[model samples]
Target: MKKHIFTLFLLFNSLVLLAQESYFPERNAVWEQKSSSDFKIDSEKLNAALDFAKDNEYSGSRDLRIAILKGFEREPFHEILGPTKKRGGPAGMILKHGYVIARWGDTKRVDMTFSVTKSFLSTTAGLALDQGLISSTKDKASDYIWDGTFGGEHNSKITWEHLLQQNSAWSGELWGGKDWADRPPREGDIDDWKFEKPKESGTFMEYNDVRVNVLAYALTHVWRKPLPQVLKEHVMDRIGASTTWRWHGYDHAWTEIDGLQMKSVTGGGHSGAGMFISTEDMARFGLLFLNDGKWKNEQIISQNWIQQAIKPSEPNVNYGYMWWLNRKGDRYWEGLSENIYYAAGFGGNFIVVDKENDMVIVTRWLEPNKIGEFMTKLKEALD
Candidate 1:
């Protein structure tokens, strides 16, 4: 009788575990939706949160080309070097336990997701590490690329971790964009920045697209294939993301790899060209991270990589491997969990992953300043 009781206890635990498993949408299958009531969430508060997002759409021009140029007007010589798309109005998805709890606007409309591309770019590096293509993040980048990109004394000292953390301080030019020219200090003129000594790598944090592109270029050589293909075969396809998503680089960012000329993609759409993806697909990505890089049964990206990717670097508590953390820092969203991390882009694209709450939030074209408040509102609803 005691043996039979043990068997029943095991069966009961298995059923509970099965019940708590997340629902993953199959390729081309309609994603399942659940009412807020199903999750015991306050329906009125949830609707109010969605209404707030809709009411406060991004202030940028719908013609993102104009918005991109105007937004970066402070930077000299900035130009649209790749493709740009007119954006759709305030589109988003809120997923709880892998089922859509709330959705608004054109969730299927593909739009440019500027610097959020950096998070995806970093994913490629994680893949390389997982596959033994990169022995370690601590490995010097110069060891992999003996070419002049990492030639200088300062650049040679940079490691994969430095680039991933956006603290490489890599000095030099790539594809006609100078490292200092990307985003110069507000108080300094062109000559001041151009001649200034670069900070020691991994000691300072700076958000320069030129340096970001260098990382992309290095990873291209590391993977020996276009990043989009690597991502598609290994990640996006595996996650059942829609075929509409695209990754792009500047028009002149082509390089010869494996006897074929391929475009080395940028980590952002700063001067245009990064990720062009729909809201639903973005939610799918957030879901993958929410589950610690697992999709249903398969671990597409190792949990070790994801954990490292979200760890706050010494230089920036709010940043980790190109993903933004909600930890105490300049960019922290007050009243939110410090454990939350997200991918944010210009013109207000965000893919927020809330592991503590078992939720993912994807919002596009919402005013950049409103994210903190928006998140707070969403949290209130869930509470």
Candidate 2:
């Protein structure tokens, strides 16, 4: 009887702790916070894993299973997420071992990662290339654009690369007020915010969510199926990600976004954060990327893509197609010589690939305002 009473008390205390995390003010969902010690993988082994992560974080490796349990609170790196005039939180870090070294986080974890979803979306594009579903990135965007009539002359001049590079130069604040009425009404708006479509296509990175959303539309057309279907065969099937892993906008486990899925501009419309997965799954993803798209014997993502994806070739932004570049760093690689490439996600998510060291470091945070400093420190540590 004493033990039963104690267990109930513990659960009650956990409920109270969970109750503290909600902001809805009305529907407060209670959950207990676990510490890193509660994780499936041991934290002590972290250092031992760094060497492997430094070596093969790109490819998906099943034999490597050193998952780390990182129980830490998340702090927003954004100056905006600072004190609610109520409380404050700070970012924390931990490292994990497997094929490559990685760090995991556990705090008010995993908010929507915004444009980072573009990287996932780009995987679908890469698969299209792999399966020969789509012919080329050189194709004209106007061809797939809903308004095919206006696609003549100058509009046709815009290539899919322009769209990928965000060089198409569409300057409307894709997230703000609605000035654009030429297109259809965006989905999921309780209110109608207008957007002004920037007349220019590539002069500057004046972000237009609609532009990337157009890629969703194009993928739908080229694949002749929803973007979700292609993602299943190409990425999910190959990676062995958790079933709990879900790509939002995909209706079913089998049925994909068949019709008009990618029609809207995803940047503003679909923040990259919608896709959810466990931190370990994310590390697997980072590893696959680091490995240049090899998951076991299956060459899921192509070598040409791994090479092209990492290359710093875009004209305007330091950003690559969907992948971000860590190009400007010193000529150092795991105490060797190799260029570093990475998939940088908004809100402090990074899959840092140190090819020479054969290491891939993946991090998640509410906002690690410390990213810039942290990366610098990390690179130094590896060197």
Candidate 3:
């Protein structure tokens, strides 16, 4: 009898966990942003933001140092920031009835943004497109690149469109299998990728790290400045991100398009990881992008660049340059348009831009609900 009861209890816990993971409590969510009578925002939804902020540690900047000794690396999360300092969440908090509008957890603080760095890189490519530097997106990326594999039969047909879309069917051991984990985590980050055979290219959209490195090679080789410097002038500096945040190429400078000193990218690298900024500042970026790359009447990132960056290039998997699109339901939710896009990172770091509603939501945390769950929640909120 006790065994049966234990099995039942375990089953119940499993069901609850599954529910939290898959089933979203939509009606229970509310908004709280009220104060501005001019803006067409749901006061109740804004109120929900207020309630969300009560729990997270967003009122402070956490610091941490990673030192190497004894041939090992040591990192402590809670102790990194050395006890959190006091900070106001954000002016007119959206979670708690229009009080604070910002949040930051340990992971969101000093942690690195891995694949996110790609978004920045792609944005630079957009600027190049808008500035008339690259001319057109149709040109094969291999023309500017100088790799043997890129020139071979399959890759020769691949275009810039393919690389940005991750649709480049470059033949490598990485994408030719089902268990991607068995292949190296990153070809550019470390020497873990075990490449064996080569096959046809530009067939499917699979996550490829080395493809980004190839893009860096193409862009930086043409621009004549390292990808980091190009990013500084084209994206970061324009976005008012002079903060300590920055991008790092790779340790193998020969293989890396941009290289200076060897160090972990401040917050994260590009792609899944990259430039780190305060959640407040990150929201500012989204605000600028949502408003067509202008802030206080200054054309930071060109309007053309903004459109090219967020505008969907293809509908295969719903991606534009480096941003992701909402998958479920209609495009218009609440006052937001279907054109809304987001910069998502591992561990639930999100920078959402809803141009239709003039809303830019940014969330940073070591952990949040699962990726799909959180995105669905935000979509539901807008809907």
**Candidate 2 Cα deviation (angstroms), residue 234:** 1.1
> Cα lDDT of all candidates, in order?
0.93, 0.48, 0.49
Question: Over the stretch 277-380, how does candidate 3's per-residue lDDT look in tens digits?
Answer: 55544554565676676655567677866666655544343566777665334332333346668776643456777554445666654233333333344444
Give per-residue CA lDDT, model 2, range 288-338, as digits (tens).
Answer: 775678766668889886675655544633466777665544322333233
CA error at residue 34 for candidate 3, angstroms? 8.9
Candidate 1: list runs displaced more than 4 Å: 1-19
The segments of candidate 3 whose C-alpha lies over 4 angstroms from its true place after superposition are 1-47, 50-110, 147-149, 172-203, 255-273, 313-315, 327-337, 366-383
lDDT of 1 by residue, 128-175 (tens): 999999999999999999878899788999999999999999988888
How many residue-pair clashes does candidate 3 contain? 45
Better model by lDDT: candidate 1 vs candidate 2: 1
**Reference-based TM-score, model 2:** 0.60
User: Quick one: best TM-score, which candidate?
Assistant: 1
